[model samples]
Target: MKKGSLLFVFILLLSSIAASIGFAQEIGKDKLFVAALGDSITFGYNLQEDKTKPSSQAFPYLINEGNAEVANISFPGWTSSQLLGALSNQETLLALQQADVITLNIGSNDYLQAIGLQELIENQTPIEFTPELQQKIAAASAQLSQNLQNILQTIRQNNQTAPVVFYNMYNPFGASEDPFLLSLHQAGEQITLTVNQQVLNPIAAASGSLLVDTYSAFSGNQAAFIIPGDIHPNAAGHQVLGALADQALASLVPAAPTVEIVFSTTEKTEGPVKVTVTADQDVLEMKWLPGEQTADKFSAAGNVINGNTFDVPENGTYTVYVKTQEQLEAVKTFKIENIVSKEEEEPPAEEEPPVEEPPAEEPPAQEEPPKEEEPAEEQPVTEQPQEETPVNETEKEERTSVKEESTTPVVTVKKNELPDTATAAYNYTAAGAVMIMIGAGTMLFRRRRARVN
Candidate 1:
């Protein structure tokens, strides 16, 4: 595919997604939404700057200024049945659901269509309340009553608290000079009174809707309220209706009661919890119930639970309801599961004594000076006599044995005395052996001399 075609397709896909996900402009949540439903009287038929659009001078638009949003659902020539049918449309249903207030000016077309008033007026025929016309009006009146009931019911199904302005029809031909028109005006006035008193008034009262007295307000002022030669209201007429609608709505809707619930604890724990409730107005009564409940569903009775503090038992969710003296009610709900007991309720056992450590030994004492004491006695010893005769032999044997064992003998020599010999003969014998050796050598020498001679 070409790039241009592909781009166009992508754009179309994005547009479709945006539409599907709701790019439609939204009414501000803070602004009051007023849904206006009726015939051309509420639509501002000839008063529109652009004929295709709803009029800026319409009663719905004049009802409020910057703080409100208006959805003018009225169209040209919409009868009670048509309006009732329109309530099923998506746009109308949405408007009803969002409306904080609604203004209704229907049933005029129902009367006109049934009686063929336009045909009579176009042919310049004189007006007469004939049996056929009376039959048609009566039938229309019955239909209007049923249709009005259904319309209010539908509005409440979508929005429970929005105030409705039920407008009764007016006689627009009262100021006409033409005989036929005057006759038509007189008959219309009677029919208008009958319809308003019998059909609209009772229904509006039963539905708790505000009934705007348009018939009385526009009684003889049709020239000022209605456009010249036209049954639709002029800008001035719409303005007057707007002021009346505003007044009726203010009275119809009571001030919203302010109420609050304060729980002792929002958490789960063991034991009962305390709840306190407060309101800006005088509280007639209050009640406690299991789980959450709306004001309509609050069926608790037999006990007036209103007070400073109420104890809620453990392990469940509960809703508390407060009804003011004005009959308006408010509800608050909370969840809790109390299971654990408080510590102070059960005291702990006494603790054991701590273990003791052994004592340490004392360090050694420093040494002190010695004290004098008596000496121990020694024992006596006995002496033996010495043998003198074998002294030399013993000494000679000792010397020989010592010499046999070892040649050198270790002797202790005192400082003042020489080392004594073991025997005197030992020294004498060593001298004799040395002298005999000398004699033998001299004799041997002499014998050799003689042999030579």
Candidate 2:
């Protein structure tokens, strides 16, 4: 062959190989493998392990539902420093190789610890204000910001082609007045915002990467998103994250296709209890049997179901059968275990009757004169004056002689039947008796007075 003909053949071969490579790249782009790296919040910490399905509201699960395969490498309490350390490990490198999309959330812990350091310095200082401590805080904040930048740089080095999305730190403490904790939280917020805008955004913009703004979504709403006394997001918070993931993934993937089995729980006894069924897509009609059930029991509060609260009324083996759009069927079984009810325990019955020592013997009784004693003395005095001259001694003698002379009952004079003259005589005798008493009293009083003198 001529030299020009040989060169033309070589050029044609090179063109064909280039076309094939381009087609391969296109095909690879159709599918995605996502990996999440960071702390407990990225792991969906409070979410149940069994319930952490691809349908979960966590961002990874949401991305998977959008047709990407996802893996979560987040551990509780991991900081940017730790995450960078992990990237140097073989396992993390392998994971990075497999990941087409990477979501990173870190640096919050570092910011938190820096705040702790600030507090420690403040406590150690006796002065209310210290310029040295302030300088230290500023230095620490700058270091933290730089550490986050380094983390993003490391990720870029590992996966140059992958679209990296850096999630900004959220304000975990909302509207709190606790100065130390609040200052820490505010510092984290400000530092993260700066890092995202000045560092992460520019890098992403230059490299054609994606940036997911989680900070704005959960900023002031920290109280609503985080579990009380915990650093992790609650169910509703997961839902918010899932929604954001849905939006982010939509830009990268085609609309997702979903098949769900919805059922209402009525008088559930031992499930697999029968449940009413419905479907979003006409793939399968759901049914319940005595022993067979699978696919999660959709809850009223879950992303899918609206009216039913899925519950296992009693412990038993249950299975759910799902029929595909092609009329093919699949079934899965779940064991329902007994859940202990929360109830107050009854206190033990009163052991023995409280021992009662006979009420301490009352002090010996002291006798008290009758309340009517003075009244009784006054009554006798009044009666003596009125009866001063009741019948003379001669009348008394005559009555006794009459009683002796006759066998009949003796006739006694009645004091009440005395005549008017007898009454006048009684009064005169009373006056004489009173005069005598006065004379005796005066004589006694004069003798006492003489002694006193």
Candidate 3:
């Protein structure tokens, strides 16, 4: 073949492979993934008063600016060291590996620890500024800086280009104005600033990360953002953070994966349909749900045992959706009407026809040679012929010949047409042996190919 012809053929092959293997990939994209890591602020601490799940208004929950998945591992009261420990967890590590955007908020508790303060802001407490406390502050500051550096390194090991946003800590004690408490608050604010500017900011800049200044967002309005006398943000504060994160993530949204479901009737009944969604061989962790449905329909809300296909046995209208790989990507629903169950179907029983009575075998008609007319014998009526003398051997033989001429011929069958059982058994045995040989050959060929691979 000429060089141009070979090149054209190769190009066609490449196109065909891409079309088949990446069926869910639209022109050029996959789902966007966002990973949120750190403390109470990112956890939406006081946003949900009644539930453990984060409020819908939480920043992590609101990070979805497009086709996106969010993994929120934030916990309340977590210090920089605590977060550094959490990075070793398999779930957190896996989420980082797949992240397109990551938000980090830590070291706030470390700052609080530096001052040796409990969870309280007292107005009348006296200040005893000692050298021992100053040493504690310095040590806490050093630990916070090291942990922050390590956290960034751990995340960078898994991902290179994801935009990691570092949230600078906000001071929540502006409402306390007693002389001693006011001085303590000032020191706390300065500690937070030192960590943000000296520890977090430079690394973020060097790593091409975004630094969101939460201090400015809550600086003048700390009482409104923070819960009364508590460090956690309120619902309104969560909203502010969510909006900030959303604005930061506006440019990183990628195209979502789409799935096409092809269905086939499992039986002639057509009520039970087999719904198929293609997936990569390595894919695991799938969640299924009925995305759209009639009120009367039974919902399909669980993982399917089979990899890509599910047998929908309900007789109602619905669309089932599937999410794969930590619920990062999902395709539109696979629609189905009545899917029938094959086991429930039975073919109608056939009625045997009434047997006919065979006609009785008729006796063969007896045919004797028509009686020959006897020659007139007037003398026999008058008198019997004189008795013959005792017959000799030759005369007996003549009498047997006369009797043989008067006997009738009998009919008989020529041959029977019944099948030969031996011949039929031999033919079946030969066919079975041939099939066994073919099957054995096929299995051996498959085993050899497997070994070679």
Candidate 4:
């Protein structure tokens, strides 16, 4: 084979081995652990298919990717303070410690309950911006600030390296569209904006984590995202939220992590040598490389796992590689001795040289009368076959044409209930992340956590 073809095959072989190892790892592993802390959004409130199972379209299940196990400690009507209180719960803290990713959304309920915005929304009365209410909102904002920092601190204490995702609040109050309610809507929106900027942003900055702008993701798109007659996001909105979480997980996944390769037997005396390579540390994937590839390019793409076994076909050097979700790569090389087969081991028997002999005198040929073949001159006739090649070919073509005509159209397109944001980059831009305020028609705590998407 050409060198390029050999390289391609080498890559493919490694990928296959990597896939097998990864498959085995996946089968052997427990599902990826993910934890979320927040309010009703995290709890998956009204969008229930039943009491026991949460909505499949809810952000966590939507982001499940079939391999993640989520510990959603959030509950309905949970304010930031309530989330802080729940952090003391053993089950919740354990989940955080074991989580590969965590998401948090809080403070919205705190703001809403404090400002009594839900009461105002229900009553259809103009909010007087009462002095006492302003003090409460300001106090709520302070609590939100402190609670957010504390939440992040607690998460770090559990899983210091797992990425944490928190989103800004969305505005759910029906705004200026209603002339009589302009002031109320405007005031609520202003408060939502305040929480996103003043409360969430600084905390995210301090924690060195992501602050997804749910406000941006849901703003103006409420008709598609919010529940009818309620402030919480609808099932569709959950997808958007999930997509944001997915993006954070995708981006944070470290490049293929470095691995240490191990071999069961580094040297071989015959064909079919089995060498097992391994990484000492935790890894998401692993690969086996043939002599043709450089270790540098082994991690360009494809899933791999902790250990892989290879059947060496020839006497040559082979490299084993390991990769982790953290983007590290480890390599080790081992050589197999020139292979010796049993058949080739024995010596050949000796043979004597043959004696030379003089050429024999030309034997007198018996004279035979020359028979002249005059077929062309005599116009010899030839028999035609029963079927002509052209005729048979034409019949075959006709049959093929008939078969083609009888074939039915195949279905190739499919509709997905979920959004395809797998390739969508997170829109961190303020212009792109339009805030959609959502609450109990009053406040929104949009904290969410981060992992294994």
Give the alpha-carbon lDDT of every model: 0.74, 0.56, 0.63, 0.65
Global Cα lDDT for candidate 3: 0.63
Steric overlap count per candidate: 2, 5, 6, 47
Candidate 1, residues 371-453, lDDT tens digits: the string is 33333343432323222222376766778657434454434335574445544456555545555656667778999999999
- When summed lDDT is taken over every stretch of 10 residues in candidate 1, the lowest stretch is 19-28
lDDT (0-100) at residue 394 of candidate 1?
Answer: 70
Q: After superposition, how far is residue 424 of candidate 3 from its true place, in Å?
A: 99
Model 4 C-alpha lDDT per residue in residues 1-453, reported as the tens digit of each score: 456434443543343333333323333245656687888888778887563545555687655454668888887888888898899988888998776667888877888888787677778877777789789988999888767766766676666545677777888765556754676667767888887887787666555566688887877786788897777888778888988877765654344444444444545355777666555567656666666455677747432433366676777776666655544556666677756665655577778899889998899966554454343433433433222113265654554444333254433345465433322122222213233222222322323222222
Please give each candidate's TM-score: 0.51, 0.42, 0.46, 0.52
Local lDDT at 424 for model 4: 19
lDDT of 2 by residue, 102-148 (tens): 77766666655654644554574222225654565466556655565
Sort all candidates by lDDT, best to worst. Answer: 1, 4, 3, 2
- The residue-level lDDT of candidate 1 at 214 comes to 92
Q: Pick the candidate with the highest TM-score.
A: 4
Instruction: Tell me the TM-score of model 2.
Output: 0.42
Question: Could you tell me the lDDT of residue 6 within candidate 3?
Answer: 50
> Where does model 4 exceed 4 Å of error?
1-30, 49-54, 64-66, 128-130, 174-176, 255-453
Q: Please give the lDDT score for candidate 4.
A: 0.65
Model 3 per-residue lDDT tens digits across residues 253-308:
43334556677863456455667776542344444455554322323445554667
